[model samples]
Target: MSITERLSRGFVIFDGGLGTMLHSRGLSAGVLPETWNITHPEIVTEVHREYVRSGAEVVSANTFGANRLKYGAKAGEFCLENIIRAGICCAKAAVGDTGALVALDVGPLGKVVGWPGGVGFEEAVGYFSETIRIGAEAGADFVLVETMNDIYELKAAVLAAKEACDLPVVATVVFDASGRMMSGSNPAAVVALLEGLGVAALGMNCSLGPEQMKNILPEMQKYASVPVVVQPNAGMPHLEDRKTVYDVSPAEYATHMREMARAGARGLGGCCGTTPEYIRKLVGALEGITPRPITEKKLTMISSATHALVIGEQPLLVGERINPTGKKWIKEALLAGEYSEIAEEGALQADAGADILDVNAGLPGIDEAEALKTIITELQMITKLPLQIDTSDPAAMEAALRVCCGVPLINSVSGKTESLSAILPLAKKYGGVLVGLTLDDDGIPTDVAGRLRVAEKIISEAQKHGIDPKNIVIDPLAMSVCADPDAALTTLKTVATLSASGKRTLLGISNVSFGLPMRDSLNASFFTMALFAGLSVAIVNPNSAELQKAYRAYLALSGLDENFSEYIDFAARRAAGGEAAS
Candidate 1:
């Protein structure tokens, strides 16, 4: 089955904490060679059977720390082939004809690559390729690259695994307490980098406790286009009797599993300190729950405060504040024919991180079309982030769109006949991104499905006008949360449905938190959640530090942070500049 199909069925349960299980069977912390799987087949088989009996759908082989480097120079002498083969055979025996998956577990190379330790990317790839070859040859179903921190290192491992065999690969990175990789890689950069590398699934494992994972889940789900797996610790390890103890009971741990399911996680498993009972409880808790489907919505790239809406990637934020729609000063400037102020505002937003700037000169006292032309010209001289021509007047939109440099985005076309008739043609003519609102000539639809129908109609009309589906961005129209508790969810559901259609989705995120207390919290949470529903762009107030932080966090968790170097740089700068006050 496809990854989405697997997720939709129910949460896939991976077996719990292997190291702890090994220790429980009288293996000391630094003793008992794990490579003994070749010499002591019966013990390994018994452990695999225990996990199977405890209800694990997948049990990892006992070959985690068995890499050649870890097993020392005697690795060849001890027979690496025999060790790996025996482990897989043992796991297969435990699984029987029930057909549970077996993953060839690959851990880090222990030494850092490049400047820090001199291990080059090719060398690392070669090392991991060896493991992949061994695992595949031993009949492993998939390769699990877990607990990785460096993006380059992870990339090496992924490349090696894919090159070695036809088996699927799942790559996971471990985050530090600060929600970034040890090297400062965040989840967003991780997802972006790994997804581009073609991993079957990407996720976090062996990080902080469930509560911490819960806080980061919204961010994780937002940027992930593939299945997301999370295997958090039972809780932070505590020193007890000279060994680590996790205070969370199996029941308590299962509570977090349910939360993960609700947060859109498709794969659930436990890390350090968990046992088979934990997996059993997790399975029980997630029994009837279904993973959320990707939304099938259309979105248009527009001017936004941060980045330009990338249909399949980052959401382009088009800053709406630069327009003279309702502001008296803006209107006065337009009537007075002052272009510098418009240029200055556009420049400021671009510098502040706007991916695109929305230009509107629709003042009651001015010639809208003429003013729009002048504003667009001036702004073009100051920035290159792209522009979204914003005007209800079709003539003005056409005029500005013609002069705007780069791939311009028409602010909108909609379900309304006039809008569809007018803006759709301009979007098609200019070959630019188109925004579709889920509303008709009558008014906004209150129900999600109605809004979705309107969105579909708008998409059909845009396609009829010769616009590509990828260029269309669908806005579900966020409503006030206080006005109706269900309003936000309704918009989210619409976005989710739109996403599944393989079209881009956008949302004016700040609208959802209107009139609500702690609006930032509400807005940030909603923005993150919308991303999970496949929202590709957000029209948000980029000036808010809280919002920016949340966006950065989301980007990092999504694995878009590259090697996490950006997040690390940001953190280091924050600390050096006293932005992070202790």
Candidate 2:
């Protein structure tokens, strides 16, 4: 059976760390393991055979650091290509007729991708694509992108693997004991983005041993829709007699491996300090265990480079005052290239209880692309809140999405064919949560059902391009309640219907009160109604006391603000004429 088919059957076993074994065989520190594939092919084959004897169902090639970025220039001609070819050949020779699979091992580039003045997105893609191409040409059965920390680099590697060949791709990242990647992506955020990219499996590897992995397994199991892979180190490294040592023993490691399988890990392996004995015992320990059945998790979230803002836990308030619509000061600042002014606005909103700041630089005459990039880059440095990339220009959207430094929420794509075609690719490419406008080429739908149909059409189009519904937030076009008395009713009905169907819904709450008296009261009242209708997020002015009061009241009533602490605190501060509670 293929690797994907076997994953559904039961636990799939991968080999232990090659570096640990190589060190025992007199391999020096800091030397590339791929070099041994060429100089001592017999040693490489021997290591693979040991894993096969220990019952490793999948043997990873010793090519983790064999890319051109590392092996070229200083190395001789055909160094990278020859090393990868030999690595695959060594695994095949060792596992001949043993029913074991060979995985082309890929690792990170040792540098951050998409940082300011760092490796560009396509440059990083090219780096992994070249390595994947060599492995595919050398006839590997699977591609394992391991030890990834940055989500952007992970995206480039996965995209490269898919484009380079039609092999099953398994991705795992390094997480600290606190259960976050080095890039600040928590387990839920990583699962959402990686699953949206269509990886065959997702999990955590390295940094910690089996015991620490057990702590992170629940989070991965909670969000991962695909098979979960866990490849922890034998234990954290410590010094013993001037040498490195791992704390966990073979039997202890085996026991924890059993626990990991019980916690829903279908794919198990070892990282640093593990050897054939550990794998042998792990295989024996999991003999009668069954892997957890895959469950589809429909969590809606967006993130900055470090934090994920989960929607639907409570009503999320997206601060919508940063747009250059009627804000003369913001527009003038953008024209003058004064990003500190924009950053100040974002900082103020973050203090005022905004979960996300909506950033738009669509001035009439200026370069929207440059302005959006400038503002997004600076705003991220100022506030920890995730920014919503609000733009009508596809160029600006793509530019901002590429360099925005986190998983942003794209302000919109519409039901119009041109809009969907233009924006969905960027969303899919960059992995952003999309706000889909429920209107078509025929114009705004006056009735709730018509708007619902438009939403369905947009979702269908998005799926055709392989975008997940979890990454989509439907906006049912909040028309002005003053112009059409039934407009708010239609929008609220759409919100209630969509939310019940497991779709995330957002509403531009201020639009419902256009041209009305005491607009803040109208907006606040309608905002409360939308929350009752299960609205996941609202785009409104966070600076408005009326809207914030309504939000805090909903949270207290809905049991979101624990013990009504936020509500009571805000009430006391307001009565004392102190600064408002954010």
Candidate 3:
């Protein structure tokens, strides 16, 4: 079966805590290196057999620190290829082709990459390349990059594995007690970066315990398009008899596993101090339980005038009409320095059921940053709908993001290097959500693939800066149908692609109807199409009844409304208030 298929049917159980298991088998950790697989193949194969007997569907080979860099000059003499091959051969022998997969475990190179620590990117990549090539040549089914802290180094490992072989790569990072990597890379940022690199799976391993892993799991799943894997330690380690002991029993470990699985883990296993009994109990606890698939196309975290509307568990329709781009009255008011009109427009959108309001004040002959600040301050006083700070000016975006309470989304960066370089640091500094436009300095792409390429580049760049993909919103530029008949469909395709990348999507919805007759009908139709294509947010006039209706219908149809109670109650309220004119 394909890896996807195996993962889809409940959690894939990987072997647990090899170091401890080896120690239990009378191997001295400080003296006998795991690389002895080349010299003493029988001893390595015994440990593999024990894990297999304990019900491990996948057993990792004993090549964790067998790389040339770790072993130095002895690596060439000891034969790294033979060591890796012997480990995998031992693992396969233990499983006996019972359909078990062998993973070649590659640990860190024990050096920081880029700045401060001095390991250059090219050198880091080279080290991983050699390790991956040796592992692949030894017939390992997958290369497991585990316990990474620095994202730059993780990127190096991923790129190397992709270049070295065709085997799937699973990249995992270890987070410290601070809920961020030792290098300050958070789970969301890790998922965004590694997923963009096309790793087979992304997750946390060898962290605190199931409880801490549970806390990080939701945040990780929020941005992950790929399956999430978790292998928490049995519990915090305690010293007894001059050896580390884990307090959580197999049953207790299984309890945590159930919780992690409920939080949306697709693959579950144990890290340090766990054994086959722990795996058995975990598999048993999850026997009859099926995890609910994450179906939300776009997940968003909102900060409203009253409360934040994070758009994963429910649908959040952020009204995008307060901007003065095409609206003549809005533009005229801004030009006239009439701030009240903009505030009233924002209030009107909230009254018309906007969950969040996107505020923009970009116009000729105006202090964009000052105008944005004034509008945001006034809007906060009038309505509780969260504000999406929409502006091309970094000064303006930063100005709004600083004083804005709660998490706010910045209008965007594009595929262009300058925008990413300039805006991403701001997004990271202020903890701001970002909207990445699917266009570069060369302008928007004309085809779905081109749009996806641009979107991928944006996602990749955002990840490099340690920004969460959950916080990055992708806007595939929506063009007008009067100019190109396929504009709407192409935009939809781009939205779908962005959703599949596990990033939220935003579009200026009314752009599809520009210079066209019966614009409202076109706008509504386009909104519905975008929703069907997984458009999470639309920059459109929320005051329009047709557009609002289209959004409501889309939410109900998407199953986000749950039993249609919200839609029915809304329709009923509109009818009772004589607002059912539509």
Best by lDDT: 2
**Residues 1-582 of candidate 2: C-alpha lDDT, one tens digit per residue:** 777888888899999999989888979888787889888889989999999999999999999988878876755644788888989999899989999999999999887786776786678888888889989899899899999988768877887887788888999999998988887778877776676567888888888999999999998788777899999999999999989999999999999999999988999989999999999999999988777788877777687766677777777889998888889998899889898898899999998889999999988889999898888868866787888999989999988876665678898999998999999998887778999998999999998889999999989999999887888999997889889999999999999999999889999999988898899999999999999999999999998989989998999999898989999987887777776444
| lDDT over C-alpha atoms for residue 23 of model 3 | 79
Give the alpha carbon lDDT tens digit for every residue of 78-193 in model 3: 66666777777888788786777888888888776654556765677788888789888877888888888766677678877887898888888898866787766666557645
- Residues 142-249 of candidate 1: C-alpha lDDT, one tens digit per residue: 888998876556767887887788887888888876777765566665664555445778888886777788777776677666788889899988898888899788
TM-score attained by model 2: 0.92
lDDT of 2 at 509: 94
- Please list the C-alpha lDDT of all candidates, in the order they appear: 0.74, 0.87, 0.77
Shift in Å, residue 99, candidate 1: 1.9
- Candidate order (TM-score): 2, 3, 1
Residue pairs whose backbone atoms clash in candidate 3: 304-386, 305-384
Off by over 4 Å in 2: 115-122, 162-165, 404-406, 573-582
Candidate 3, residue 291: Cα displacement in angstroms equals 2.8
